[model samples]
Target: MEYTLSPSVTIINNRQVLVSSSSPSPANDRRRRRRRRRSNGILHFPFVFSGLSLRFRSRAVVVAGAGSYGGYGSGGGSYCEFSCLNTPIEPATPAGRYLSSVLLNERKLFHDAVAETLEKLVKEVDEAYARKALTVDSSEAALHRRIAELKQQECKTSVEDVMYMLIFYKFSELRVHLVPPLSKCIYNNRLEILPSKDWELESIHSFEILEMIKEYLTFVIGWRSDFSVTESWATTKIKQANLCHIYTTSILFGYFLKSTTLRHQLEMSLADPIDDIIMNAYICRRKNLVFGHTHNKIPTSPFDGKRERENLVSYLTGFTSDSLAKCAQPNSKEALNLITKYSFALFGDVGSDKMISTSFATLKRLVLEAVAFGSFLWDSEEYVKTVYNLEEIN
Candidate 1:
């Protein structure tokens, strides 16, 4: 039997030996060498003495280093050096996009959880209200108890904790669903809640609604610019120590009108009172008015500096009109001077408890003082005449 070595094999022999074996009848020796090489050194031939020729003898003596083969060298030697032929391998399937999809799924799950909690709260409140209304008893003691229990339970469980649990569970579910290629693609893809084209209109509508709500809030908290003694005392000394509350209420009313068709109409109404004050002062200044003069001329007096100046001018003008100019005067300057002299006697009077009591009494009286004054002014011309008479008498 014969075995053929693979093409990977290479054979080499000494050139000197080949030339020595190429003498007469060299063909037979060459044939034997070829046969031996082809058979992978398995064929063994004993040397023949009679037929021994120099060529045959030379060929039979194998050179030690020259005899080497490439294919799977003998058992203990290195294996054959074959060309590396790489077979085609498929590319790895991607999992990056699927990760984002899983995250989105988790977000949706948590959102649903929060929504569920809000819905439950709404339902509980509604049910409690319904139960209270259905009861025929005058007092809703049982309903109150049930509501208290529900509130306690809800207070113990935070909305954030519920959302976190939902997110955990949803992530697990997403991982399971993403086993297939289609599921992975669907989950990872970006999902938009609203279409792009409708966004502008939606934004405009939202702003309009917000403006309407703000207007409604302003209307519910009304405003008054004219401060009443009663309102001031009630707010500062009795009810609460906050001036901002009254100021904010007044500003809100002004802003509320700006949102309506009544804006210009209200502005016209406000201009009347402002014009009255400015016009009266301008007319008085133009007339070169000199009022009465009242002075205590005492350094120890604690009268307000501004109030004293005002009183001095008032008295001096009265004196100029009555004595120097001989104009129609309201009353006697001596009596007015006497009244001004005694004004300092009204200070440093009340104790702490007395002050508080007086403040409370003053607040009560002032509560309806503005309304009464307005009523008196509107009712009759005689009322105004009486006020002028009283001023003249004083």
Candidate 2:
């Protein structure tokens, strides 16, 4: 017979089974009862809420015979229900946490201590160098000795020791001029301070050296390229221009060598050459009048007429400090005003041979005047500025 099972209930051949039942006595009844029991056992019924009758040989089996039924019985029921266990267990404390914090604090303190020690060492070194307790060569020798001692102590050279050595060395080199035999002192100081193996010198000429000093002077005075006549030419029209570029490059090379005295000397030499170039260019620009000749030929002479001569004199006077104040500030305002005034003075005035000749003479005079003025200015302002700047740096 077919059987269907439901939650907490069992059916055999569409009939419900009682959990408790007594055994049937007749052979037919016993056989029928055994068949029913076998069918019920196949259903595997669980505990039920309500009492249900189990048919055996057309008789009802009650709860009292549940144990005897064997398959569906009250004796098989559990006394207590089970439940699930679900809670998290706490982990044991880690041993490394406290140690790690202490280590971090110690490292920070060590870094701070090292930094303070370095600063003190630097200050002591600078004071010693200043007082001549350490000569440039001696200072360098000391550094080498110290480095060697540190290497022996630690069995290896550290980046920190190297850096400290470099700082002391640089400060000494920078202040070389303050010591005696300035050039030698500076050179020695630089050699001591800089890494010994990495220095190079450029090939240079004397004229070029002179020109460089002049340009350096102008640069310090705040002369803008746009305001100068040299900027207008594609080529360096004057020899001083070429010289200046060369000298400036050379001086820069000396700076790399850490030779303060050599650098100063180069700068000092430039004063005369720079003055001459600036003056000549200024005068040439002032007489640059485009004369419209009757023959349609360009006039060779720049200053021809009485009016041009008067104009030239007036232009020169206007460049004076008092006159420049009517225009702008510092000395640059006067210089710029002079450049502008002269630039416009000769614009498009065409005239006769006599006028052209006069203009040419005026141009020559202006050039000569500029040269003299430049020479004096270079020796005075440019020289002072360079020396002062170097002093400040040291």
Candidate 3:
């Protein structure tokens, strides 16, 4: 049997290779030019290949195009189809554009950027771990030292690091769904439940805050769950220590644990079975903590970080005005009712918790705390620090 093949085009890393008939037709050339003109600005590429004789192989020459797209996971190859897009594409935001540039670069700029940040965080965590190691007895100290050693080896490219990168990418998709009001509400509420501790107030990248919360939540979940049944003592200890590192990393990075409440679903998706156990325990222990909700609808416009900041600022203005009015009439039934509802919204139905009662005095104090938290949310800096827990970049 004999077979004939039509001309095709394959591009690898933006370099175009054209496969065509030895006797090229003027019609084909015109068609190719028209196709290229139509396919502008779209990333979708179709793959096509056909077999031919060595005689025709000589015609399979490379053609340099004026423009090209760059990315991974196309079997290291692609074929651009210059056809009208079936659906309109969403517009790009500044952050999305920046991420796309970093990601599509052949020089691996994105990986390097993330690696630099991850390394610094790991080093600080290692030093903290080392200090704790010295305070323990010889046997315990040896175990701690071993754990530190393992962490040094694994910290830069750990599963968490990969997951962090994934979360960063996912941010582009979820940016529209990032509910600042609810995020702020949940974050502040969770922090109020913690033991008395002073958090350093500093601005950090929004995604940095999200990643830190995720790491902390994963650690919290991992710490409470028992691993002795199936895993060795060293494995369990090391796992717990990693979680501790993540927790301390959150603190050291100056990332507020409260911010994760809005993005907890993303954290849950990235968590392992052991991490899930910890999350489940938290839910069982505190049934009413409302993490912000999400929906599946995609937005028409790209997520504008600037617009988000502006909206959050606008929302905080209204939140403060309303909250203050209620605070002014502290003794009114309306005030009491307002605090009770706000408390329930933030902390969930705390009816079971012995420490948190519904008394007027208790509710009043909670109302005041909400005012303080509202202030905290409004004090955000214009730009996020590249490295949290580090000196603010000018």
Best by TM-score: 3
Give the poorly placed runs of model 3, Cα more than 4 Å off: 1-30, 33-125, 128-149, 158-385, 388-394
Worst 10 residues of 2 by lDDT: 82-91
In model 3, what is the error at residue 261, expressed in angstroms?
A: 33
User: How high is each candidate's TM-score?
Assistant: 0.15, 0.13, 0.17
Give the runs in model 1 whose Cα sits over 4 Å from its true position: 1-107, 136-140, 155-160, 163-394
- Sorted on TM-score, highest at the top, how do the candidates line up? 3, 1, 2
* C-alpha RMSD of each candidate structure in angstroms: 53.6, 51.4, 30.1
lDDT of 2 by residue, 138-227 (tens): 647676556544433331112123222222122222221111111111121120111111111111113433333333222222122233
What order do you get sorting by lDDT, best first? 3, 1, 2
lDDT of 1 at 239: 15
Tell me how candidate 3 scores on lDDT.
0.27
lDDT of 1: 0.24
Pairs of colliding residues, candidate 3: 221-278
Candidates in order have lDDT scores of 0.24, 0.24, 0.27
